[model samples]
Target: MSSFDETQDFVVVGSGGGSMCAALVMRSAGKSVLILEKTDLIGGTTARSGGVMWIPNNPFMKAAGVPDSLEQASTYLDHVVGDHNDTPGASRARRRAYLIQGPRMLDFLIGKGLKFSRIAQWPDYYDEAPGSSVPGRTVVADLFDVNRLGDAKSLLRPNFLNLPAPLEDVMKLPHVKKSWAAKKALARMGVRALVAKVTGKKYVTAGAALQGQMFLAARTAGVDLRVNSAVSQLIVEDDAVTGVVTEKDGKPWRIGARLGVLVNAGGFALNQQMRDQYIPGSSTKHTSVIESDTGEMILEMTRAGAALAQMDATIGSPLSLPPGGEEWPIKPGAQNVAAAPHAILVDQSGVRYLNEGGSYTEFCQRMVERDKEVPALPSYVVFDSDAMASTMIAGTLPGARKPDPWYEQGYLKKADTIDALAGLLAIDPAVLRKTVDRFNGFVAANKDDDFKRGARAYDRWLGDPFHKPSETLGTIGKAPFYAIPVIPGDVGTMGGVVTDEQARVLREDGSPIARLYATGVSTASVMGRTSPGSGVNIGPSFVWGFVAANHALTVAG
Candidate 1:
């Protein structure tokens, strides 16, 4: 429907953060670029995300005088991810390469006019996990002005779950302990700040901000952009990627890249078969809204001879299944509840699992493991009235402008006694009572013998600092107890077509698949097992896009 079409030098697929970064990078280099988005509107899952792009040892970190070093970062990664011994060489190699080049990529984008803000308070997910830092690792993009992109607005996706709100506001929310306090505080402070923010609105998050800023920079460099083109398949010549077969206005057209095909298309989170196969017992409850995110591109790459990396691995977190789906007992819309300060995660058998106060991925993985060992994945987060009081929770800051709808939805349940609530939840009464008694004892003693809930700095970051003997444990002795069901969820899947450290697609034999590249959720993550700090996905997306750009440029040269 737009002006540009058909003849173009480069065709990038999927408008997620990864694809946008690649498109923008190539565009800025004075290369003709066309983004072939499958969906009518572009912005992929990243648009609907928290929009924080984590880059460690970045210029922002240095400028802020926050202490960090590559040695420290690598050490921390090594500690959390463990040895790369039996991993794919490409995965290991890409991570090493990403770490080395991430700072440069971050600085390059900043230099190219992408504004970045330091998440100074956001600590590494595992600050106590081997080589972790207390802070100075996670960086977020400054709220970008969406109006600057002109016609690109139509192609952009709505900001995901947290919309019409900024990260500053989304961070503040209330749970049982601080629900009323947070409600009253937000009423007092959220309105003025929100009004000011919108009037001076700057959009940020996922690929939109990354791509928007990059797209603006690229346009300044005179890159040609064509939207509404869907890539049907790859054009291969003599065993190398030559271009793409795309449909414009419902007409087929062959476009020549003359350089490379960058597969920044997102992963297969929405692919039902893939989800069922890789992520067991999860297809029914996925949280990804990018319906166009099928594994077609990944399939295309595999057919083109690209080796897959860690295809079984995924980024997992707890998500509530919609009311109709059957998998496990869950309280739908629990995320709407203010994340609790004194909640303890319990398995279906009414037993505590891993430390509940951890990264979404870690928590989900623990739940998965627990379910695999037992029979169900649904877990309960239990808290008391005092815990539901005015304590500053991890994700919910008191002054958050945007209210989490989950809280307003009554995903949380309140009752006068533990046994009474257990009966409602179908939890075994005797087991539930004993678990609460033990957990309360741990709260009083400031120790969680069962799961070591708050024993580490990483766990403490998302926990209540003011809570008594145990910062992570809160006694549920107060009458009118509360419980919310949690399920395994995720930002997106992480397995995909294997690519070399240069961001070039590679074959099973490890030979580069010429003119083919991928990044973001399109490829397996560079970080293997453990998720480091925030923005881990976005930071590398920028870096690999830069890498892919240079590789494409080299081919063009």
Candidate 2:
């Protein structure tokens, strides 16, 4: 047993959005806070994410002239999430709490000097739903200069860091060919870039910017942030979580919490055992989350008598896995490469199983759903020369001079003809040929009969607007076809310790565990089984973290 060395007024596990927000809120309320991060770097998986937070009726949305209401949001959630008993995830009360508190949390962060802007072009994942908006309710942090963070920037988790421009600029590039407004947006971005360069500031965008602002706020508020400290166990007294035992420097160190302990240490995306047990049949090797999300906090919370919910859920997506067990890191928003024109995803039997232009989560769910009947563990993304030339195919750059090394390494198969490519992929040649022929007919007719591929607004968003009739439809008639294997990969696991509307960890019998709180992927997701929109994961996380902090402060007072 490790002996107690010190005590804090409040202790927060994990250094992601939830934990950082909680720590900052508590510190602002005149409470001493300590944030323990399991990995050497802070920020957790939130730093690697898209950084968009889906908050309905937020002030930013209102300021942008996008109308939204709690009633409409509830109706939308009812359609997407359905019944709680059937979904077995976030309760209605919890959903209501998130909708109500989300704006307040955003305002709180703004007051703390964090800069955020509404993403005016991004739409809800299920835009056809009753409460869905075309110009979404999502907001993202502005590009932040690393110089503002000073020495603490080195301790933050690194993001994929693909597009250095602001998200508004990045989003406009796809529509530049069709919209004059998009071209103007790009020109504005160019000016911003020149200004940043002249100012001698290195700006980071997306998830990195969001986490950077939170980290700076936490440091400025006097939160005791510790990295390379893994919380292994919780200290309980009278059935209440009073402290935590962490593995630091190859030795166990115990630290007590006088107010409460909050577990926001992320999910088990990197733990093979947990992946096999919870999200079986999904490829464990293709997850996009950081390697540090091993569910240690889930185990610690469970050991402390917390109940679990939605263990079978994940924030899943389709990912290209290279051969020889090598992993491909995809930046946030890059998964749309699969939805580009002329590409079609097919199962082992060479059958199209889903809308090719659907959300990544929906695409992965289709892969899993089809796996029950056929061998769909590794689906093939097939595209032709036109697709390779016209747009990026599965993260491959557009107009590449030659085949990538992925082809030489057997991760990608290429051939001069459709039948030949199917043979190389070990798929039925006849089925694949017929499937492509039918898909070509759909493109020519400007309508998809089977899965309605390019029918939705979200589908068209991923496609080339310059294309005729539909943006997502283009004939795969060009020769020299290519195929790459895609698997069921995830951003993170969606299940963990159960928490109520107040963010208090709950027991199996529906009783709240005293002095224990949870948020982020460390608790059951408030979005239920479906992703409502971009940043749904981080939005409720921030709100619940705020709720937990305020509740703990009230208890302490």
Candidate 3:
């Protein structure tokens, strides 16, 4: 092993949102920081996500006239994330720390030149829960000009969609009435791109934009980033983490840190062995996270006496894999399409198991629950031609005149009638027909007696606003029914090394490991098994990163 001569004040082993936040803070605090990323790209799964942050009472929310308080946010967390606090890794203190410091950290980042806008229409996952907000406490990053980063932009991970506007603007595309308003939006976007190109700018939006902004901020703060370096082990001295050994260029290099080592290397979503050992389902091929996240840092920390928690949990969702068994670089889940109107999910028995309009996480959880009784390994999303023509389905774009490749490849089954479709799906024809008839009755009555779909504000938000009576409940009466197989996929695994309120990694005895900190998916998620809102995954990550960096800075002083 080759040992590096230089010693930094802090060493961050990952380049996700959490590590970026921590590196920014440490650099701002005038500390020598080194960021080591295993992959060539700088951003991790954060670049693949929606890039929204669920920061209750954030300055953006306040500016938008959204009412929120710490107490109210605490109550909401208590209601949703209750009992999980009693678990080994989760605690009430960590939850409070997340809620209290989240907005402050976001505001700090905003002050450091990160632009964000409030998502006023996004509802909390459980809006009916105590102290929940109808309009969520989520804020998404504004579109960023990646040209500001110049050549550095190439190092950033690409998002699922490369739209050159904010996500809010992108969401309006489906609602645009094909009139001048729609033409104007598209024209404006094109003009913006043209202008940006003329001005030597490259604008990116959503998660890509968020990471671009963060990269710019970190660069401005003079963070030393080293990509293609994977941390192999933590260097411990007197029971305190002092450095790390990284594998780079087919060699091992040891680097020292004066303050601490922050483990933010993400989860093991792509690791099949870990998934099989922890997650409920057997398949590990369909995660929505980047392939580089294989829990290396978590394993290093665990070897150094760190405790683990919430190992069985994941931010699960239902996803339709690509045809011909070809995997994309980044797999995008069919979340919105599955929740859209006229689409009903059925088990192998051709029976509806849960509300199709529920949150993606809950939908996957229900699939897992149903799998216990029946072999619902691959659930079917049954929809009609109207749904296929009116909106996107299983990644199929709207208004596509031709049949999808999935249909031609047999990944999607289609028939002129529900019974025929069920026959094609190898399901009981009578049961599927009865299920569709019952669902149509529920749509006509504007009430779901079976699953209570479209009852919550969140469900309605994901539904068709133009549909009468209910947004999420519409009849699947149109001919040419279609069925697509959906498997349990995850945004990322949520469990990892356990940490305390200050983001310090802890031992099994609940004692902190000195000079060792963790943030993001490297540690047990503070949200536990519940996802409170759209950005819950990223919100606490930012806060904990800030907390960890500040604490390490104090130690350095």
> What C-alpha lDDT do the candidate models reach, one value each?
0.67, 0.82, 0.82
Worst 10 residues of 1 by lDDT: 329-338
What tens-digit string does per-residue lDDT give for candidate 1 at 1-557? Answer: 12223456666787677665666667667678877777776566666666677776778778888887787777877777766643452355666787788887777676776777776577787877766777747766665667677766666676643333345444544343445644654564456447657786545443455455655665666655556666778877788887888875678777787677888777787787887777657663455546676788898888888877666666665664433323332213332221344566677777776777667777777778888787455777766666655443223333322235434555556678888878767788888889889877887787878877677665665665455555566677876776666777766777787778898887888899888888877887787655777777667776788789877888787
Clashes found in each candidate (C-alpha, N, C closer than 3 A): 26, 0, 0
* Residue 34 in model 3: lDDT: 92
| Stretches of candidate 3 exceeding 4 Å from the true structure | 1-4, 177-184, 247-250, 400-405
Could you tell me how far off, in angstroms, the CA of residue 228 lies in candidate 2 after the best superposition? Answer: 1.5
- Expressed as tens digits, the lDDT of each residue in 92-209 for candidate 2 is 8888889999989999989888899988777787887798887888889999887788877788777776555777777666556567977887787778778878997778888888
For candidate 3, the lDDT comes to 0.82
Better of 2 and 3 by TM-score: 3
State TM-scores per candidate: 0.86, 0.93, 0.95
Best by TM-score: 3
- Shift in Å, residue 346, candidate 2: 1.4
Per-residue alpha-carbon lDDT of model 3 for 358-464, expressed as tens digits?
A: 56777788888898998787888898887787776555567535456766788878799999999998899999999999998988898889888888998888877
Candidate 2 pairs with clashing backbones: none
